[model samples]
Target: MKHDIVIVGGGVPGLTLALALAQSTSLSVAVLEARDCVRLFKRDARVSAITQASKRIFKKLGVWSAIHAQAIQSFTRIECWDEAGNEIDFHCETLAMSALGYIVENQAIQFVLQEALQSYCTAQIFYSTKLIALHEKEDAIMLSTDTGQVFHAKLVVAADGAMSFVRERAQIILDKKDYNEEAIVATITTTAMHEQIARQCFLKTGPVALLPLSDSYRTSLVWTLPTAEAKQYMDLKPDDFCKALTCVFSKRFSEVVVVEGRQSFRLCKQQAQQCVKPRIALLGDALHTVHPLAGQGMNMGLLDAAALFEIIHTAIAHHRDFGSHAVLRRYARWRKADNFPMSVGIDWIKQLFAANTPVISLVRVSGLQILNRFPTIKNYFARYAVGERNGLPKLAQ
Candidate 1:
C-alpha cells in the first residue's frame, strides 16, 4: 500500500493525528496497529485525565461528542495536600470554567477514536500488523510488517510508544531516566462520595491520587511507590490490599474496598533526542514520556498530535513537502520548548515532595500554602493543568 503518511502505531496519538489530518486536509494516511481491533475495544482498567484543551481538539476532530457519550467523570474541584498538612484546592466555579478536566477510561477514548476514524476519516487501518523494518528513501519511507505486507509513504510517524520500533530503526537516541518506582492502579469503592473532586495526597513514599469516576463512590486509584512496595501491594489479597490502601488514604476517605483488578507499571522518564529526522517524526510516548504524577502523559501526547497537524496542514497549504526536514523540525522545536520545561517541572515536584529533610519539607509546605493563598496564582496553575495556558495549537483553542 502507498500513502502520503504512515503512522507506526494506532494508539491515541497516532489515531488523533490521522483524524486531524483527514478532517483538515486530503492527506492519505495509514495506521499500522500491532494489536487486533477487537482486543483494542476490551475494557482497559487504566483511565486518563483529559485536559480541557485536549477536549477542544477532540471536539474539532468531531469525536468529542462520541467520547462524551461514553463513561466520563468531570472533576470540578481539585484538592492536593502533603503529609505535612500543606494543601491547596482549585474549584472550577472560582475560575468560571465548567470543570477542571475529565477522567475517561482509556478504552473509551480508543473505541471512540477508532469509530471516528472509520466513520469520518478515510485512513486505512491495519490491525494485528507489526512493523518489522523501516527504510528511508531519498523521497519516501518504506515499511515492512511482520505479515510480509509492505507499505510506502512520503512521511513516517513513530507513535509506537516509548519502546518505539520505528524510533529504534530511525536510530533516535532517548535521554531516559528511571525513577526506580512503580505505579499501582485499580478501582476501589469508597464509603464517601468523591463529590466530583480529584484528590492527590503526597505521602512519605510517593503520591496517591484518587480520581473521581462516573460512580460517585467508585474512584480510580493511582498509587506510586518503590518497586518492591508496589509489588507487595499488587500481590496482596483483595481484603488485605484494601486495608493497606485504607491506611495510606485514611485521612481522606473511609471504608475503602478493592472492587476490581490491580495492575502496576514501572515509572520512567524518556525524551527522544530528536522528534524529527529526515522524513520521519515522533509523536506521543515515542517522543516523550513523563512521570505520571501530574496525569499529563496522554494530554501531552494529544497536544503533540494537534501541533504536528497544525504544522503539516500549513505545509500542505504552501505546497511544501510535509516530509521535509524543515517541516518536521518545526514540529520538533515547538514541542520540545513546551514539553521540556513541563517534564522538568513535574520531575522537580516529584522530588521536592519526596524529600525527607525537615527544611525541604517545610519549604514544600510553605510553597503549597503560598500558592493556596493566592487565587490568581492557583488559577494560573489551573489553566496550565487544563492545557489552555501556554502556546496552544489552533485545534486546541
Candidate 2:
C-alpha cells in the first residue's frame, strides 16, 4: 500500500501533525504505533505545560476547544524565586492576555487529536504496527512493519521519542549532554490555593515547579534533583514523601499530600545535528530535547510541527516534491536555527542554577532581583515564553 506520509510514532506531535495535514490537505497519512490499541488509548499520567503558541496551533487544528473543555488549566501568573527569596514575577495582565500558558494532560491531547483524526478520511492509525525497516528510493520511501506489511510514502516523519528508531536508521547524529539529574513528576494537594498561578523554586539540587491544575488546591509537581536523591525520594512511603516535599518548600504551603503515585525520568539536553535528510524528518523529542526548567519541551516540539506544516504548504503550492532534499533542507535550516539556541540557553540556565558556590549563588540571587525590578526585561521574557514573535508560523502567529 502507499501513503503520502508515514509517521513512525503515534505520540502527540505525530498525531497532531497528521491531523493538521489531514484537515487542510488530502494527504494520505498513516501513523505506525508499536503499541496495541488498548495501550495507545490509555490515559497518560504526565501533563505538559503548553505555551500560547502551541495552544494557537491546537486552535487552528480545531482541537483546542475539546482539549480546553476536557481538563486544561490556565495559569495567569508565574512566580520564580531562588531559595533566598529573590524572585521574579510575570503576570498575564501585564501582557494584556488572560493566561501565561496552559497545563494540559498528555492523554487529553492525544485523545482529542485521535478523535479529530477519525473525522478525516485521509488519516489512518495502525495500532500494533511498528516500522522494522525503511528504504529510501529516488522517488518514494518504503517501510516494512512488524505485521509483515509494506508501505510506501513520499515523506516519513519521526515523531518518536528521543531515542528515535527512524532517526537512528536515517543515520542522523545527535549532540547530547547528560544532565545527571532526574525529574520526579506527580500531582499533589497543597494547603494553599494556587489561584491560577504557577510557582517554581530554585534549589541547589534543581528546580521545583508547582503548576496549577483544575482543582484549586491541587497542583502538578515537577521536581528535579540528583539521580541518587531522586531514587531515595521514590523509595519513601507516600506520607513520608509528602513530608519531605513539604520540607523543601515549607514556606509556600502548609501541607503537601501526594494524591498520585510518583514517576521519575532522567533529564538530558540533546539535539540532532540535522533535523532532515531526503525523505526523512524529525519532530518533537526526536529532534531535540531541552531541559524542562521552563516547561518548553512539548511547546518546542509543537512549534517544530507547525514549522514543518508551513514548509509543506509552500512546497505543495509550488508543485515541489515535499520529500526532496530541497524541501527537507529548508525544514532542517528553519528548525535547527530555531531549536539550537533555545537548547543551549536552557542548558546554560540549568548549569547556572546547578552551581552552589557562594559567589555564584549571590550572583544568581542578585540577577533575579534585578530582573524583577525591570518590567521591560521581564515582559520580553514572558512574550518569548508565550510564543509570540515575528516570523512564526501562521498558526502560532
Q: Which candidate's TM-score is highest?
A: 1
Mark the regions of model 2 whose C-alpha exceeds 4 Å error after superposition: 38-44
Candidate 2 similarity to native, TM-score: 0.97
lDDT of 2: 0.86
TM, every model: 0.97, 0.97
Question: Tens-digit lDDT track for model 2 on 39-139?
Answer: 34443458899988999999988889999877889999998877777778899999999899999988888888888888888999998887788887988
Q: What is candidate 1's lDDT per residue for 52-87, written digit by digit as tens?
A: 999999998888888887879999998888776778
Off by over 4 Å in 1: 39-41
Q: What TM-score number comes out for model 1? A: 0.97
